[model samples]
Target: MAPLMLFVVSMAQFIDIMNGSSMTVALVDISKALGFDSYSTQWIISAYVVTFGGFLLLSGRIGDMYGHRKVFLLGQIWFGLWSLVISFSTTPAMFCITRALQGIGASMSVPTALGLITTTFPAGPKRTRALSVFGGFGAAGAVVGLLLAGAFISSVGWEWIFRFSSIFSFLLFVVGYVAIPVIPAKAVTQKIDVAGAMTATSSMICIIYYISTGSASGWASVQTLPVLIAGLVLLAAFFWIETRLVKNPIMPFRIWRLRNFSSAFVAILFLQGQFQGFTYFTTLIFQNVMGYTSMQTALAFLAHSLFAVVTFTILGKVLPKYRLKPFILTGFGFRCVAALMFAFVQKSTSYWTLPFLGLLVHVIGLGTSVLPAQITALKDAQNEDQGVVGALYSTGMQLGAPLGLVIVTLISENSVDVKMGETPVEEVMKSYRNGLFGVVALGVLGAVITAFMMPNTVPAPPAAASAPTTAPVENSTDVATVATVGAAAAVVDLELDEALAEAAEKMEMV
Candidate 1:
């Protein structure tokens, strides 16, 4: 039953993540069919990203309060319905609007899916294994999305992408309603932090919008700079509200105090940024420079998906035996090496050579790093806090995509002197290589943070033998002594109750 339920949940994650990357190959086809200009075409992707990233925190909290399973079902129905609408879209505006709504649906499901896993499985090896499988499905989804998009575009049409998604989403919703256990919401009486939710969501939307569009629109232009500053201001105000005013904040600040939490957060951010940047540029180089068709480009990434699947499966069995630090550092090391290799790609280079090898190495690094980072972040969370904690981790990933693209786009643009018209292949190659070096820099930064900040090993629970036992109470003095001991025991128990609640309260109040 657990395995079956995991499949349903993991499949949901896979489908949601697939939408993020599937558009990479399908975008050109979509642009042609919908008559979208270059600038407006970008909105097809950005609309989804903006809504998805912006709504994640609020959705996660909603799941925690309203029952994860219920929210999960609703999200699936919403996603499926919008996917159907997208397939029928005749205009660019309709497609982009549906895509944005689809993102909101995804935002609702992803964090809750994670919340369900963390709360369903007890912490330790069982939960670790579950997470590894869940993460593996998510990682595979990106590459599979590309592969399927190419196949669909080459054969039927791009509309089939959304049509297929709609079918799968509806199937998952039906299967999930039966397979997933109905866990009750947390019993806390506090209302949702409406003000905090607004500020946080608005800040994310503004920041991500700026990051996604700033390169196309000048960074200091009226459109980008003001939004960036407004986002920062809203972010600051959100923190102030969370720290000072909100009795129950949408995002509690205490989760940051968990062991290795901050380090894992930063590391995953870098990892995701590099991943998005590398894949985006690689796809462009394949089609624009090397002149591969969409199908050919998808086939080129087959190695990456295959290797990631294998590595993740193996890691699920072996990850419990080792410490996280070594895997994290080694993963980053592989990423740096792969990006460095990609930096030298030439127009005449064979797909079987540098690009192929780089794909293999990059996926290996991703498998090695991402799963452990997820475990590190979620392992210490209290069951009640799992939804929001997972949301924070996922939000880092969502933001990283646009942030990574922005940085690499700037690097590539600045590196070459190509004109607005058709440019030579050699100049384009040079630009891509320079952009890849930026990815290498990101990998190096992740490695440095992992080396210095992440602890060598996860803290283990105290052995049962070390637990204090109470003797029979005999008299008044002994009863008093027992009371004192009981009070101490209760404190210890609270600390051991995932160590997130009372500690978070103390830290926030201070």
Candidate 2:
């Protein structure tokens, strides 16, 4: 594969993964800079997340209708534009809105880029190399983002983070414009399910809005309650519409018939919620209560980031030799233990204690989780739904972050007295400890879901992906090199699921 195509397709994933973590260390800076109160400030992260989650399904459908390359280029351009605007943002509203727009661009770029990769590479060793490159980068982007963001936020400025992203995005835009070939759309015509998509997106936005600001609004204010109820109504309507009204839905009901698939989806959804919630608040704990600088907080997280790389590197080698069950279960079990360990952070806690130990263990879990989960989520999915399932898997991962952050925000800092400046660090620490206990519970639940729900054996890669090639060889990028240089899967993202029941006619027919 040409380096330019690899860069174009994988860059967006890198940016998205990087953005998610890059902001965490800088979040305290953002809050103080913009004069945002705790409740309103949550939007800095949740705004991007709400849009990222809401817009994912619609964006993929857009790719199917328009040319994937065109949509991808447009998306990258949009992201570059938004990143530039974000660096110049002078107010909280400006920052939040621009970040949301950035998420929209990201939503547009990712699936289309993957589609471009698939269409660009023939379905043999070439496609495998492309996918291995693609997935490897997708997994690694978050840690790279964290490292750079941490180093630069203090050395340069948090604003430099966006400036760098803007520059990289534009460079990719130019390169992609010149190099990314236009691929013709397939003959399959799929409906966009406009109504269901809108309802679902709107419902999620409203619900997240309610969770975020509802705490500061007194949780049941007349204005907030109505929005919350309306979100529920819209959510109910979305299900009804998808199940009965739409000729073809954004999420096909038939896909849920695979028990493993369904179980994987729920497990991922919960795991992500826990993971992001943990990251957001833990970032706060390290910087705020622990009195660490942005640089220090970033450095503290360095262990998790480094170990994630090592674990993935080992998995790439060992996965082919091992049944996924041992790796998958052990990874999830480590995650559960890590969460439980993190729940023990204290006001006087040493960095090397539960905080460091737990983070180290958690990264190992993340490394093991991503590949098997990706393999599992797409396990029995037909080739036609590959794009959609991949999109769904990505969505399942992206959507969890904001909701988890919201729940943590509410539980840890919701008291009106705290806003009134009557709260002490001791009392605040009490709330933080309690809130983290809930996080530990979520992690345990996710592990439980996987242990009992996902298949106990390794699933074979899909036939289109794994079958031997008799087709004439084309010179390709060295996959072993790519695997050796494999990337990181975030504790906060890339949560895929495990395998399902035997591929019988009932589920495969779709």
Candidate 3:
């Protein structure tokens, strides 16, 4: 039963991730088919990214108010329906709209699915193993997706990509209904915080949309400036909703108080940021300076992709024996070292030298860094909060990555005419190096935060060796669990308990 549930959850994640990778690989072909230019084609991807990041918090909170199973099933149905619709899209507008809806569905499913996993597995090796396969799919599935999309586009057609997703999604939907438990709505504690959710989701969409457009349209764009300012205003409104005005906040302020979680969030933010910068600069080196073919550029990343899968597989088993701090600390060190090495790369550097070695080192850091940070952030997580935590985990990546890439793009934009074959290799090398130096600094900062703020010790095992197979058991320990956080978060979570405690204190005072 547990295995079946795991299968459902993992496959849900696999399909969601594959959607992005497959789209990226087939972008050029799709553009030609849909009559899209370089500028217009971007909307196909950006629409999906913005909507996914934007609605995560709201969706996650919705799961908290409703049962995760209901929400998860609804999202799956939504994703599956859109995947079929996408195949019929003949125009660019039609294609982009369908893609955006698909992304929203994917976002809705992921956090709720994560919530299900947290409830299914106890916090020990069982849970660790479950999460490993779940998280590992994200990295390995991307590479696999590229290979599959290329194969399908050449042999069958681009529409087959969505066709395949729809077929698989239906199968998943059937098995999920049978295997996953249904929690009654009466089990829910709080009503939906609609005001808080709306403001936050709108603000995030506005911010990510601004960044996505600004990167392409130039930072000084007059149209882009209005979006940026509007996003900032919405952000201020969101903060006001959460901290000052709301009686029941969508995001409780005290979730930010977990030292380990906060530290992990910061570290991963920098890690993702630098990784994006490194990928952009590396792609330029291969295609622009070294003049590799598109196929060759894709192939260069294959090794790192494989390395990530194998490394994560090993770490899943190895992590139970040691503290996460060592792995996180070591991983960030590797990240800094690789970025620093890449900063010194010359125009004519060999494929097997520092460039190749640096890719290896960087993936090592990435594989190691990602999982431990996830483990640390989700540590001491309560059952109900799982959806929100998972959403936050992903949001850091979606938002942090854009910020990193934009900064690097700005630093490296020196009018190097590689597309027209007019620029000097010497100029290209200078631009690449400058971009990489910024990444090196990002890596270093991540390492420092992990060292100072994150927990150094491995967590103690679950209070009992086993939680019941049918229902999740709550932890009773005093390791800064939900009650402690809720007491600080708002007047809502512990109202009954808090009122009693206060009354008891008053009787003793008399």
Candidate 4:
């Protein structure tokens, strides 16, 4: 019951993460409706990611100091209020500010939700299942966000994305109030690391803003160079401060010493960059070059979500019984292949040949990599450390997408004009493909890093004869026997529970 409760709460957080990307589908609409030029329009996307990534560590630490549930609710309340502001936005500046606020809300929700899951669920089959569902739904919502955005953009208007998100926020607030239990009281004793938090946040904002704006102003221009330099310098200062001064830093310097953990974090960064690149490039190709309608573009991505869910379900069920390393390897290998294949996709190609096949393979490969990696990344981490673990992993994801977007935008802009019809579709797509190839190269590098760094075996079982372990082992064995003997009784009890949970999720999804 407790694990199930945590799983649902995490899913709500996934929905918030998904909402951040809905604007991609509405980018064209937003450009037209808000009268944004090419340069300003990108901010409509970049600002959200920048704020989300910037404050993530602080939000996680805040949740660690205060209660996770309290922080989560606070984020929802702020997000719901700002989402309404987004819906009513009449100018690009207004939209950007609101989106930035939405990003803050998201940062609060996502890491805290994962912290809740890690703290609440004991490591075992039950937790594994819940995590599989968590990873699965997050991937699914990203795909669904595009579809929903397309549908809303065309059927009603682009503003509906914000409207729907606002409504969803309200609903989640209500549901969380009734369904989610508070985190155990002892977990909230850590003090907030104010200097580390502020330095990190400000430094990250400076860097991300520099990169996001660099395309409009040349990288060498005065406007871009100062911000980039300041950001780099301040970020260095952040690390120095964290290591030397802070008693409890938001990102503890010690965790990076574990090769597997650092490797896993890098892997997530590369994979997420690859994922966002694929989705962004493909969607642009379909809509901008191929002249596909919003509905068509949205529907095109349906296969990605479906294939990811299917692969996740199969992989999740089997990984528990075997060493996790082989699955992780296979997933990365598949991901590299899929990403490389996607890099070769052409604007003139048939939808059935490269695009569909590439997306399917990528989705399946991503599914295999993510769930196991997420588990391995935080394996055996104490409850006190879960906030850092979640923050670290999710920071990889949030930072990766914007970084990828910045890279792709620079590549595509330098080589081809997507906004200009004078540029050939093939040439534009070629530039996009060039950017994707770089992302794929990063994935291949991540795979190699993971191969060497991640432990190559299952976790070792506790010693059976240890004096401290004896009583817990005996009780656990007894519990296992009782569970097996009472399997028939538990099966009936669990069936109703599953049905109810599904119904609840469906209601929330609506």
Those runs of model 2 whose alpha carbons end farther than 4 Å from true positions after fitting are 2-7, 37-39, 65-67, 113-140, 143-146, 177-181, 187-191, 345-354, 406-431, 461-510
TM-score for candidate 3, residues paired by index: 0.85
In the range 1-510, model 2's lDDT, one tens digit per residue, is 356887778877787778777877678788888787876777887788778777776776666455666878888889889988998888999999999999888888887776666555544344544554565566567666667887886677788888888888888889888888654454555667889889977887777667656656767898589988999999999999998888877766666776556666766776677777767667767865677777787778777766765666566555654555466667667776776676667668899988999898877776566556655565554433445566677777775655565666667665323532466656666666666766766666667777787776543334655543332211123333333444433322343322234345448887
CA RMSD per model (angstroms): 9.3, 11.2, 7.9, 11.2
- Tell me each candidate's TM-score: 0.89, 0.79, 0.85, 0.85
Which tens-of-lDDT digit does each residue in 301-384 have in candidate 4?
888878877877776676666666677777767766776776676656778887788888887778778778887777755555
Q: Which number leads on lDDT? A: 1
Task: Rank all candidate structures by their TM-score, best first, as comma-separated numbers.
Answer: 1, 3, 4, 2
Task: For residues 1-510, write the lDDT of model 3, one tens digit per residue.
Answer: 778998898889888877777775688889999999877887877888899999998888777667788888888999999999999999999998998898888888888888888778877777777777777777766656665676778778889989888888888999999999775455326667887888888888888888877878767688678877887888898898788877778887667888777888887788788877887777667766677655566676677678877877887888766788888878878887787777777757787888788878987887778888887877766766777877887788888888888877777774333333555777777778778877877777778877888878665465433634445532233234545654676666578788999999999999
Enumerate residue pairs that collide in model 3. Answer: none
Better of 2 and 4 by lDDT: 4
User: For candidate 3, which ten residues in a row score worst on lDDT?
Assistant: 470-479
TM-score: which is higher, 3 or 4? 3
Off by over 4 Å in 3: 187-189, 340-357, 415-419, 462-470, 473-510
Superior by lDDT: candidate 3 or candidate 4? 3
Q: What is the lDDT of residue 114 in candidate 4?
A: 78
Clashes counted in candidate 1 amount to: 0
Query: Alpha carbon lDDT of residue 43, candidate 3?
Result: 86
Q: Per-residue lDDT for 1-510 in model 1, tens only? A: 668778988999899878778899999899999999977888889889889899999999887767778888999999999998999999999998989999999998899999888767656666777888998998889899999999999999999899888999999999998998765344444589999999999999999889888877879999889999999999999999999998788987878988677789888888998998899889988888888999999999888888888888888777766788788888888887888877788888898898999998988888889999998888776656788988889999988777877887789889897653488888888888888888888888879977888888753343322444333222235557767987998899877986777788899999
| Local distance difference test, each candidate | 0.85, 0.69, 0.78, 0.75
User: Clashes per prediction?
Assistant: 0, 2, 0, 0
Question: Model 2 Cα displacement at 3 (Å)?
Answer: 7.2
